[model samples]
Target: MNNSLQDTLALVGRILLAWLFVPAGFGKIAGFSGAVGYATSVGLPLPEVGVAVGLLIELVGGLMLLVGFMTRPAAVLLAFFTLVASFFFHAYWSLPADQAMMQQLMFNKNIAISGGLLAFAAFGAGRWSLDAKRQRV
Candidate 1:
């Protein structure tokens, strides 16, 4: 593909992926008490600390990915987080019938997000990214 097309694709990918996390981080922030309760219910260690860290990764790391700043590291960290979330909260489990489908959907979504993050890690931030500019310098 030509440079223009590649650049456009990268921009689109970054925007779409970054947009996904913004709401998640905002949700964690907006619903801090609920998040803490949920985390504790899920048996996540240090629920408050975990929620804070998760919020930071989803908000800051996600924004960095959007702008292609520290793209590689951000993507990797987000990918790891996504994978862990999938296993912890979204994995197929013996839950009540009403909630089982929702859990399945969340699991699938996290898996897909992880795939996207891995792709970004492999491809770098593209021509329009800070990583690319740094490379040029």
Candidate 2:
């Protein structure tokens, strides 16, 4: 209803979404070998490169989102990344019964996250963002 509230929501939303990826990126890099191994297990070709690209996208794109800089592009990139990850790595349908439930949950969660990213891309970062500041100048 109000600009202030709208801006606050945008900033908080950005922070909330960014947290999901920031620690994950840090952890992936911190345990680089483990991430690569997991990627390999998922049958991604060039697992090392995949892990590196994922780490870069999560870390850099996530930070850009947090600061509301390049917000639309960053959100779109992450959204695409999430969709691919959900289908490829978290494909619950291909798993055994016991593992299927967990994978399915993860897959669903990723899909929901992608929806949020898409919304952000449509709305643009609100007035609290660097994008907004640049617009004023």
* Strongest candidate by TM-score: 2
Tens-digit lDDT string for candidate 1 (34-137): 99999988888899999999999999989999999889889999999998977777756867888889999989888888888988989898999988888889
Per-residue alpha-carbon lDDT of candidate 2 for residues 40-119, written as tens digits (9 for 90 to 100): 89898899998899999999989989999999999999999999988879989999999999999999999999999999
| Candidate 1, superposed: residue stretches over 4 Å from native | none
Model 2 stretches astray by more than 4 angstroms: none
User: What lDDT is reached at residue 17 by model 2?
Assistant: 96
lDDT of each: 0.90, 0.93
The alpha-carbon deviation from the true structure for residue 129 of candidate 2, after best TM-score superposition, in angstroms, is 0.8
